[model samples]
Target: MGTQAPSDYSSSAPSKMDEQPEKQAKIDEKLQRQKEIDDWLPITSSRNAKWWYSAFHNVTAMVGAGVLSLPFAMSNLGWGPGIVILILSWVITLFTLWQMVEMHEIVPGKRFDRYHELGQHAFGEKLGLWIVVPQQLICEVGVDIVYMVTGGKSLQKVHKIVRKDEKDSIKLSYFIMIFASAHFVLAHLPNFNSISGVSLAAAVMSLSYSTIAWTASVHKGVQADVDYGYLAHSTSGTVFNFFSALGDVAFAYAGHNVVLEIQATIPSTPGNPSKKPMWRGVVMAYIVVALCYFPVALIGYYTFGNKVEDNILISLEKPEWLIIMANMFVVVHVIGSYQLYAMPVFDMIETVLVKKLNFRPTTTLRFISRNLYVAFTMFVGITFPFFGGLLGFFGGFAFSPTTYFLPCIMWLAIKKPRKFSLSWIVNWICITLGLMLMILSPIGGLRSIIIQAKNYKFYN
Candidate 1:
């Protein structure tokens, strides 16, 4: 048999041995595959693909702006009514987020562009442009004021920390310059991947200080006996008081646009669609923010109870360490707010200098814009010692779109008016109510302003 096989092997005709090259090639391919398997043996799939980002977006949005406004709110309604308002705001905010979550996922690219263009798609070009133009301007600019006023306050704290006497000399020009410049620098750079750590840090500090302050106040038994019982009994109670609370809630809960901005910055993928990322992040951010804000309000109410000032800084009777930390945290919180505020300032300048006038946006524009913003900020800070009016004004008019109106419109645009979709209806109610409240908040704000005027009558 061996000899026969050998004979066949030597024969000129093809034999089984002729298949060796092909077989060997197949074996070689198998070996290469095995080698690749071996090389990739330690490769592990990511358990938390978006873990950091989710946490970051959620925490930062909550801590940054929410903490900035909570204490002031606490002073207005007392802990009981303030907490109720915060809860109501969260409800509306959640409703909006539920609608937005679906829209964000269905079409993920160019969110701002798409959102702006929706009116043309759903209503018509005229309506689309009309809706977008005002909303964009208001949302951006209104948000800008939030950052400016709050950031100016924080910066003033820093300045006060360094210069005790210079407190009176807090120039709007300087404050605007600082934040505008900060925004200019940060806005030009790539977005940072991790904002949660800083956000959480701020949250912890804000909560800790407010919590401690409230606890101490409770221990001190400084209950503010504010008699707003007439508010509930008045003919204008529902229109003014209820609506005002709702508007304040709306203001405190604003900032969904920042979520849209985040959605635009990320790379699009079917798996990483923006619906979950954008909407969930916002809802969570608001919830965390509401929770944080409620506590500050409740505790601040309980602590200072009725004696709370617009800038809750006035209510503390703690050690210097606590005051210093609270003040520092306020500064950090303002810095975070400044990031959002700068967007409007930037857009305004760009519209005037570049978009309208056909000039280029350069470092110089950045500098000029920021300087102008800082100037405005300082003016607001100095003139409006009471934080309540600033919050109310911004919240009533500016934040309405971000909090109540836009999301409803956005949902209507994306999902076509389905039976389950009541956002637009709800938002319309909120808007109608908000418009009413806007009328009255200014009344309350005017009341606040008048009180401030009286308090500063000596200055005049």
Candidate 2:
């Protein structure tokens, strides 16, 4: 038997040697197929928006109700510090965005399609989940709550102007409910890409209202008899006020949570499968953001100084129609924006439940869970209608991590730059700044909230 086996082995040995390269070729082909699958972008024809549309989506994500608070933020920081911080935040955020895009190319097969994906890649999966998901929920849901509070207040203002007799009779909660009802329908839309048109409209609305708010501020400033210089009643030196103001600025510039999602919508071409269009879109969007944000902060603060209300539109004295239109624009814009921010939350929840837990996403479970989440946010918004307080709290506690800390951490972790090198040092500085803001902003926000809550009526 041993002699027979040796005879067969001797006969096939040369053929086996000849087959080695072919086997290796098959393995390589399989690997190439796998790589193709891994690097594949999920974009479909309808979802593949152009760069400009992506830019609009980015603008829509960023320039929501936060713009209305810039003047008050400027008041808290004074013109000097506020302008400096605004520009700095813009630059830093843009740089971090570039880092994020660069990091997308690091992992060979996987894409950081969501914000949490980047965190998961940088750190352990569990820590990334804990780090990114809660902040995203808080930032997005908290922002929606702020929208309800602010939008309701704006609607109340509009009603007061349009129907003065019934102004005191209607409750703010009613307006919130109306807005939420409209959003209930809108939020059910399938995905953010489905609403690119709405996002574009929201971007335009943001510009319209920002311009209105700025023009109104200038109009009021010119009409005033007394000269209120930029630094009047300055609180820049006040420890709590300055940090709180920085939180507002952070909130104004905070769109990182949704950037990856928006970037995924930009169609990748065969020649450029990487995120080059995404970079262009980000640049264009940031330019628009800077243009929209800088003037609003500068002019609103210059006009009203420390007298600037938390909602700048509240500070404006305009014709009834103009005020109503401006405020209504905000209401409409936030109505759309609420869904914009909430989409990430919805996607995250659905993904975890369906993918991890093996729950059915297309079933009633999805509908019920999403609607209930919306209801929960609505309940919270109606319960605490303190707009500025919510803005500051979320900005500090949520936006800081999502907007600043996580980006730096992701870059450092993925790139693994030389220890204590310039990149390392810069990341640490960012991390430190983020930590400081995280600690201080909530305190200031809570103090303001408690102070305001003392006199706040739920439906007033």
Candidate 3:
């Protein structure tokens, strides 16, 4: 045929360059919405994790223990001892975070998904598994125990008000079942934005209660005379003691996973090998946590001053106000726990049922099954009355290794020998010391478990 004029097929040809910005914008908006849905718990990207998310993660992680453990520390030691422990934890955590930030710089994005992966990249796959897995498990169990105990105490108080006649029916088993079920249900649902609000409020209320307790106790000169010889016996005392303390500290600082989960939701910038310049954000979040925790630990210890009970509420001078605020704290605490546990349980169920059994998790039947799992967890915790013991048992043997030691080891393993210099040696020393603490912590914890076991009659 003759050379005919080329037909104008530019409109017909598929070309991204020809798409209008508005049209592109609309498509991008749809994609972003779809992405949000696809990632139930988003990943923490370099950008989206700037402020609030990081703050929420840090505060939530620290609050669980500050409320419960501070009192225990104060009871065993004194205000002086409790504050010293808090300070020690703060220092160690700061050092760990600095290294963590450096590690993040190396791995860039989404490298810390399993936590163990960090270790695997650093030391070797085998060692990472051994350390990170147990450490994470322990940290998780500690959180579980803290929630169960606090939740039980709260429900008991509320039952007194709502169902005086059937008050006895609101047994620990009932509360545990209810709490566990609540977590399972919440976790299954595709909603978690509410968790941060509850955590922040709980933090505030916790601080308020600590302040009031300090005022009451300090005026009486109780705060002035408190001792702190417990440091000599604490995990920081030696390698073994330090490892145990590290386990406890891990409980005190386990919120990083929440941010890590959220990060999965964000769009990762490919080839951007830089650290999430939001080190400031992470620092600020941790600073808030340290501030909240330090005051509460100091004041609570000052107030109770070695006489504080495991439950800080019981030690408050004002029983009425104490019960009210404690109930609030406990309620918020349970809600927070529900939020935390829900995701893990749901993922676990989905993995087991859907992946292993090849069944979908979105169906109504699957949903019911998830709820049943939660119910079972709660029921066992409450009925057995071994919530705290179980937590300590698991934490001592697991959480310590996972959070503190694993991360350090992971860093050492992942980074090249060229990068391993004086700083690396210091990190290794800290990790070694933390491991030692993990070894000896079980002794004190097991003893407490034994003591508590003998007091079943008193607990009832």
The number of the candidate with the highest lDDT is 2
Once fitted onto the true fold, the runs of candidate 1 whose alpha carbons sit more than 4 angstroms away are: 1-81, 105-110, 113-122, 154-247, 344-386, 419-439, 450-460
Please list the Cα RMSD from the true structure of every candidate, rounded to 1 decimal place: 13.9, 6.1, 8.3
Model 2 C-alpha lDDT per residue in residues 164-230, reported as the tens digit of each score: 6863568878877877787767766667677777787888888889988887777666435423344
TM-score for all predictions?
Answer: 0.69, 0.86, 0.73
Candidate maximizing TM-score = 2
Worst 10 residues of 1 by lDDT: 40-49
Question: What C-alpha lDDT, on a 0 to 100 scale, does residue 144 get in candidate 2?
Answer: 82
Compose the digit string of candidate 3's lDDT tens values, residues 107-222.
54455543545666766779765755555544554466557666776666666654547635656656655556556645544433435565566555544555544454455455
lDDT of 1 by residue, 1-460 (tens): 8679878767856667787888899999979755543232111101122433544454554454444446555544555666766676667666765655455445445343234444455567788767665666665555555565566555656666556685376664466556555554445421233333444454455455455544554565655564323233456533343433444455666555455444543445666664555555565565556556666666665555434555566456455456666666666655555544344344445555754665554556656765666556545544554455555655666566655656676666566665555544665676565456455565554444465567563212
TM-score-better candidate, 1 vs 3: 3
User: Which residue pairs come into collision in candidate 2?
Assistant: none
